[model samples]
Each structure stands twice: as structure tokens, then as C-alpha cells.
Target: MTDQTVPRKPPRRARGEGTVYWDKRLERFVATRIVGYDDRGKEIRKRGSGKSRSAAMEALRLRVRDYERGLAPGADKTTVSDVVKDWILYGQGQVDDNTVKTREFNCAHIDAGIGDVLLRKLTTKHVEKLLRSMVATHSTRTIADVRACLNSAIKRAMARDLVDRNVVELVVTPRGTTGRKSKSLTERQALEVLTLTKAHWMYAYIVVSMLVGIRTEEMRALTWDRVDLDSEPATVAVWRSVRKSGDTKTRKSRRTLAMPDLAVDVLRRRRRDQDADRVKAGADWKDTGLVFTTTLGTALDSANVRRGFRSALGAVPSVNPAEWTPRELRHSFVSLMSAGGAAVEEIAHVVGHSDTSTTERIYRHELRPVIQTGATFMNRFAAVDVVAPDWHMEPLFRLPGEERTAHA
Candidate 1:
């Protein structure tokens, strides 16, 4: 074969010939040869791709590096574990609590399981096996969750060059069951809850939550400038959501949410209460600018809000319907609004959902029965002659303990 390597005094060498020529460009040993090139119409020579000319010449001299390594010249072999750690650091500091929870679940359950393995050695079999083993203890749906987590984690690993191939591409993940729709209060039940809440210390706070359907975090982070009671339509700008850390989670979540009429009225009363509170804390109260706050004027926590909501809930006999959560009140509000002939799109906009589809998907179960009376009225009307045609007039109808009844 023609020597395509750098030109030198001695050019011809066998495959295993241990000969090296000093590279004039870099003054280092390199396997050199002169070969004719069509591009320049003359003999050309250049150093081969390697760590250095010396290493390239050594590989040619030994003939061991002739075969492709199937890898690039410079690549780090980071373990999956190291890559996962970097991912966690890059993700957590800026995301909301909900996002943090999702990523944490992926890292702990999926990433940790295969993190120590070499990224290049990861294969489709490993992914399938991990999914299968997870299926034994978890339901098919939960196993699919694991699969999604693995796919996400591997995606990050691949972009960072930690893995040669992401095995998630070859595996087919099972579709999983979804989250349930929340339980909502009926119209009468909602009225009773509203009436009972008026007597509580946190009555206004409770009203703001139920009527507005603002998330608990968003409600707690409300501020004075964010509320415009004098505006023609009025509005409550939900610019921030409180976190367990007692801080706003993200800048985007701090949106200006407008208020409905009922919400506006409730907030008006709440502002009056806040004015009185500010007077009492006078010198002691730091002007936190927070619209909803504790007696001391600091921002409120979700636990405290739920604790207050629960106490008021106990007074409402109708709230005894079934198992309930504070978050479900948002569902109750949306359901009440929909049942009142409000369109899904209207509710979607009022609730600050990205779109109608999101509102429909997230709150489908909460939609109250519009035609519930149909079944109840029919059952009542039909009960007297419910069964067979003309059989009501038949003498075959029997009373309790009768021979006919016993035989039937």
C-alpha cells in the first residue's frame, strides 16, 4: 500500500516494521511515508491522528493500533453515577417543588440502580431486565413509571458523553394508569362550607382559596400590589407560589391571576381584616407586602393553612361527605363553576391552566353530574309498577308469606 504518512528519508516499512522518522513540523518521532495524492497531483504526507506523533509512530511500529478503536481520540469514561450527580445539581436549584419531587424520584429509584455501571457498557438488555425486575414487585403501571424515569436519566447521560448508547431507545415502556380526579362538593355542600367558614379566624383565607381556585402556594404568596380591588373587573395577580422552604419556586409561576366577582368581594373583606391587623402590629409588624400572612405578618405555610381550613371544615356538616384534601377544594370550585353553565375554556382560563385540554384532563373526574335527577326521578316514578307490563293488574302478584310469593 502507498504510504500516506509524513515524508522522510526512509519511507518503506513492513506492517510490523519498527521504524520511526522525526516529524519536522513538531520535532517528534512518527511513522512516515510518501504517497501520491490526486488533490495536489503530487506526493503528500501528514501526521496521523493520535495523542502525539510519537504515539502514532509507535502504533504503526507495533501494528497494534491499525484496527479502529471504535472511539474518538479524546473521550472521558465517566460512570453513570457521576453523570446522574451532575444532572441533579443542574436541575434542582431552579425548579419548583413539584419538579424537584419528580427528578428526585427518577434519580433515587432509576438512576441509583444502574449508576455505578460504565456508560459505554450499558446495553438494551440491562434496561429490559431492570424494567422486568421492577414489574414483579410493582404493578405494570408503576413499572412504566420506572421506565420513564430511566429514559429521562439516560437522556441526560447521553448528551454529556457519559454513555455511548442510551438503551432506552430500544425498550418499549408500558402505558401507566393516571392520577385520579379529586372529590368535589355539591352546590349545597359548597354553600354550607362557605357559610361555616365565615366564623373561623382564617375565614378570609379559606374564601380566597375556595372561590379563586388559586393553588395553596400561590394564595400564600399574594401581595398588596398584586390585588386591584378598584379595577373595573378587579384581579388578584398570583405571581408566586409558596414552597416548603417558604420561598417562591420559580419566576414563571409568579403570574398575575385576575379575580372573579365572588373572589373580588371576598378579597375586599380580607383587605379590611389585613388593614386592622396592620394597625395592631404597628411598630412590630414588618411591612412584608404579603397580602395573606400570619398574625405576625410573615408569609403563611401550607401546613398552617390546611390546619386552619380543616378546623373550619369540621363545622360544616356537609364537608363530612368522604375522604378530602385541601387541594380538592380547587376541584370543588372548578366543578361548581362548570355546573353553573360556565364553559370548560372559561374555567380553564380562570384557573390559569395552559389550555382547555389540560383543564379537562386534570379535572375530568371533578365534573358534577348535570343530569343526576334523571335517574332518581325515574326510579321514584317507576318503583310502584317497576317490573312486567300488565303484571301489576294480575292476581299473580303476592304479599309477604303468601304461597305465591314463596313459590316465586
Candidate 2:
């Protein structure tokens, strides 16, 4: 009798473990799994294809894991671009229009670098590579903003479970190209600018900004109601700004500044000029009640202020309009105050900084290199002992324990 050979049966896969089959047409292994039941009680299936059975099974495992974590079908295919665009469209709420535009512009850099990359597959290496590439052309601030944009977008994705973690947060920001440093006008240049821009439409805006150091946004948002020109000391409230919230940038920024003679005079002239503008505009005036406005009484946007500022500065032969911005006027204020021996604390208060450190850090270039307060106070005592070369009179104050004159 011939010995019978028993054929072994293939091992059976556990229920819901999925099945792998070789496709003759595609010459590849494909894996399929029933991820869920549809609304109609039919199996909702997901498929993963690979060149080999193990590869196909591994791919299907990733899909099943993502689905089990509560991610919707097709979540594995979501791209970084999709996540950023979704965040830009829906996550930001009640931000300024300019802020929205700025984020959109910054996100473009990310999109160009790795926007199409799958969100689930994003890694710290990918983000670091993208930022390092930008280091050559973008400023440090710009690079930082781009990283922040990516971080925020990933956070939004994580909140929705589109990403397991934020790869951007793990990547360190690379040092980027140095940008142009802010500069201030010298005393001579400030005088020239003031004299030259006297007849310009932005004269009051220029005067108030340079002399009082109010931010451009605050200057634009100033209104007649906030002006107290009739008080003992003329004052302007720095209580509002052109931001989306219409509030000051910080709690310290909401201060009531005593206007100088120059600012008070300029604002009076501005009010008179605005009345004339309102008369000329007739029915077209929008009555926005903004201290700075166009002929039609509408609020002046940043673009309008920038263009007018450049035009006004163009009249100054010493100033290059293209090289200067309106914000530099505030820098000039800090420079002049520091040069005139004003304390950093005083300058900080005038500029409405949250603290003196902020003023010192940002305006360090404008501050006096040598601390003169102590030296200045000590000089008074030194001068009391040293008689002038041409001295011919008695000392103003009697020295301690000095003998009285016989004539007394």
C-alpha cells in the first residue's frame, strides 16, 4: 500500500484582521478591511495596495489604526496645505484684515516648501529643512512668523485629530537673513522734516507722531471727543487704535498724554482743516469721527497714511522718502529724549511701554551709551567747590560751620 500524504490547510486570519490577495492585472498585492458599517448596514471597506503582501498588510494596518483613532476615512490623505488652508479660513476669528492677509502671505512660503506633504507623515526633519531653506532669503522675523503660522495650523489640525502631533513645534527656528535696521532722524533732520512738511496734508499727523511719539494706529484713530484742548494742559487720550478690537495694544498704551504746544497747535489746525474738508465733501462725507481722515471724512487706512507720509517727506531734501517709514518718527522721539538726558523710565512712560525693559531693548541704539544721571547730580557738588576763573562774587549758599562776617 502507498503511504498517503496529508496536505496542510492555510492558516485562517482572525475576524476583522483583513485579507491580502495578489492582483494578476496590476501584478501587486492588495489588502482590504471592513473599517465600519455604512448607514445602509453595508460594510465600509478600505484598501491598501503594495508591491508585496507584507507591504500591503502594513499599509492597511496604518489605515486601520488611523480609523480606530476616530479619524474619518481619507484622513491619511490630508495634506499640510489642506490643514493650513482650513485653519486660515475657519480657525482665525475676529482678527484684523491686515493680520489675516499677513498670515496668508506667510503661509505661502510653507505651501511652496512642503504644502502637499501628508499631514500624518510630517516630521521635525521636514519642518527644519523648510525653515533652513528660508534662512537665506527671509528675515529672522519673517522666518519666525512662518514657523508660527505652521505651528498654529498644526495645532488646529491636532485639535481635529488630523495630526497626532505638531511637527512644527518640535523644529527649532533657523536664523534667517538680517533685515534693515530701523533708523531715527537727527535733530537737524527732524527740523528739516518739520519745516519742509508744514504745507503737506499730513503735517498734523507728522507733527503729533514725531513730537508726542503716539503710534501711527493711535494717531489715525484719534477723535475730536478724545481731545481736551481746553483743559489746564492740553491732552489727547490714547485709548483706542485701528485694530480689529479698537483697543490699545496694551494696558499701558491706554494713557492720557499731555500734548505739547506744538501738538496742541497742530491738532487745532487739523480740526479746522477737517471742517473745511467736510464742507467740501458735502453729501459724500462718511463722518467716521476719526481724527485723521480723507477729504470725504472716511478713516485713513495704513496705505493712505504711508503714501501721504512719503509724499510729505519728499519735500525734505535731507530725507529720502523711500527709506523712511512713519514708525521711525516715534524712534526719532526716543532718540531725542535719550540724547536730551531723559531717563529710560520716562521715555517708556511717554511711549506707553509695558515696562522700561521693552523701551531699553527696542530703543537701545537710541539711548545714551553712558548713564549720566549719577554724574549729573554729582557735578552740582563739584561745581560748588570750584570757583569760576572769572568769579567775583560771594558763594550763593553759605558753607557749613563757616565763620560769620564781622559786618553781619
Q: Which of the numbered candidates is closest to the native, going by highest lDDT?
A: 2
Per-residue alpha-carbon lDDT of candidate 2 for residues 1-408, written as tens digits (9 for 90 to 100)? 668978996588899889999899989999999989978999978788899888998999998888778776677999999999998999888788999999999999999999999999999888999899999899989999999999999999888888677778778888899988878999999999888899999999999999989999898898889999999799888999989998988999999988889888989999999999999989998988888999999889889999999999989999889999999999999998888878888999999999999998888878874687788887886675584555455567888999755421
List runs of model 1 lying over 4 Å from the truth.
Answer: 1-77, 132-149, 175-181, 243-261, 320-322, 368-408
What TM-score would every model get versus the actual structure? 0.64, 0.81
Tens-digit lDDT string for candidate 1 (80-179): 6665667677744555667667666756755657777666667777777767666545556566766766676667765654455677778986533443
For model 1 the TM-score comes to 0.64
- lDDT for model 1, on a 0 to 1 scale? 0.67
Q: Which candidate comes out best when scored by TM-score? A: 2
